[model samples]
Target: MSHLHRAIAFTATLLAAGLLQAGQVRVAVAANMAIPMQRIAVEFERATGHELIPALGSTGRFYSQLRGGAPFEVLLAADDEIPARLEREGLAVPGSRFTYAVGRLVLWSLDPHGVDPQGNVLKQLPRGRLAIADPRLSPYGAAAIKTLGGLGVLAAWQPAFLQGESVSQAFQFVASGNASYGFLALSQVMRDGRIPRGSGWIVPSQYHPPLNQDVVLLNGGRSSAAALAFLDYLKSEPARATLRGFGYEVVKH
Candidate 1:
């Protein structure tokens, strides 16, 4: 072979290796995780050169998709149980699931004076139109239900309910003025410890079950270098910092 031909082949091999090192990983993320996950997706690519392609929606719907053979390599669920169930069903890599964030719930309204941090507004504010995620599908929704029940307002608020398919939609229902109030993930309305352009009351943790968000490497990604690397990236200091900024409590380990 000619030297010119050999040199061309060598250059092509190096380029192929570079592409392999920067492979893309497909991730399925819950709707409520949209903001922080998008930020992480950007940073993850910048730092590691591995691309993340996220499909955002309700975890329950994603659960159905996974069972029906979606091509996602990793799942960032809004709750721990979905991923655990996937692991049990052999759809995910066993022992690959771990809590990435403990979510916080909040009652939010666009009205300037509609909400109080102490949460007495729910009792005092008349039974107007209210929004909540469908508890059967969303952990945040179930948390909202639990919080209302704990506050002894669920029974009264039942008739005024407008159910959203996901927490993101529930936030929109109130944000768009379709409802007077809504329960949402703290990450949706909060950034850097403040609620931007809205009134909100952070629900006390004692009122409901902790929203333990977990991520799992799926069986489809068992061979994906990018998938495993992204999981490792999620545990890094920069990633944890981003989560905290978005109002999520990072789970250490």
Candidate 2:
């Protein structure tokens, strides 16, 4: 087993023997951050003995759940505005918000040569289908819409667009061969510090507003030391490095 798995095994033993003190924190995370979050959660658990229960979905849907008292202690949203909204609505801790990463959007396809680097292929998009997250629910989706518009193809591509409930789902549609191509968070398709397989173009940031993904401590989490610890851990070098590994730009804060 890896070091972390061994540590977790030892932690379980200690827990069974009533020798370790640990706490659990519930986290609501955006779909785009799923992969990195899973790895980060494991590392955080091994390092601090805190358990993270992450629920991933669209930021808008997660926000609605939080507002309805879903019992999440923290949220890593796809956009800064939702966290700020939580603060304004007294749903989150007054000042525990900060940008954790800046997301980069990508135009990707499962076929190795499906997408051209210059993105000229997008101009003559396939008749098959193109996927994107629902613009109303996901920041990535909104960014995708903006990007298509900025490229002057939104009007032409409307009929061929397939909207997924979340960015991950949009990626899934393409990865599963249900769609010819899709726009997704760069992290979704990145592996080993590169686009491990398939064809994709890192969408220019100039095409859309900055995707300043933010995290916040919720009111339900105010009393959880584990929640506070997780927030601190998120700003640590290890966590930032993991985000970088997923092709995200960690925002120093």
Candidate 3:
């Protein structure tokens, strides 16, 4: 064989090896996590040469979709429960779930003075629509309900509530003036480690159950190297830093 032919065959073998090592990971992400996850996704791809395909929405909705056989390879949920449930249902890889971030709830308004630091605005809440996620679907929405109930305002506020299917949608309600105030994930309204240009009350953690966001590798990803690599990347320093920047609490391993 000619020397050029041997060189070409070696180059083709190397290219095939590179293709075999890279893959795509399909992930279902909670709505509140959309922004930060986008930042992490860019980093992950650059570092690992893998593509991350993310579908963002409420964790509860994702659970329903998963049960109906959605082709997602990983789930980044707003709460730990649904992921655990998926494990019990044999849909997720056992022993592959972990808490990625603990989220904080916030009562936000576009008006700079709309919400008070102590969240006292709820006491004599202005006569306008109050937005919250539907407690049936979002953990943040459930936290909002618990906060209102703890503050003795749930019953009175129900009359003026505007419910969204996910926390992101709830934030949109306030941002678009469809509602004057809304319950949202701190991450949704935060920028550069703080709430910029808006008024918000960071709901005291004691007001509701801890928002332990969990991520799990699903059965669909059991054989995907990219899926596993993404999970490991999520726990790395760069990813955790992004989570913290968005107002999430990351537990050190």
Candidate 3, 118-237: lDDT as tens digits: 999999956789999989999999999999999999988999999999988998899999999999999998887999877999999999999999999899987677887777778789
- After TM-score superposition, what is the CA distance of residue 130 in candidate 3 from its true location, in Å? 1.0
Candidate 1 per-residue C-alpha lDDT over 14-70 given as tens digits, one digit per residue, 9 for 90 to 100: 434775457899999998999888899999899778789999989999999999999
N/CA/C clash count, model 1 = 0
Q: Write the per-residue lDDT of candidate 2 for residues 1-253, one digit (tens) a residue.
A: 6433344356555655767578999999999999988899999998788899999999999988887889899999999999999999999877788999999999999999998888888788556788999999999999999998998999888888988999989999998899998999999989758998999999989999999999998988876767877887888899999999999998776
Which regions in candidate 3 have their CA more than 4 angstroms from the true location? Answer: 1-20
Pairing residues by index, what is the TM-score of model 2? 0.91
| Local distance difference test, each candidate | 0.87, 0.88, 0.89
Better of 2 and 3 by lDDT: 3
Off by over 4 Å in 1: 1-20, 125-127
What number of clashing residue pairs does each candidate have, in the order they appear?
0, 0, 0
Give lDDT: candidate 3, residue 4. Answer: 27
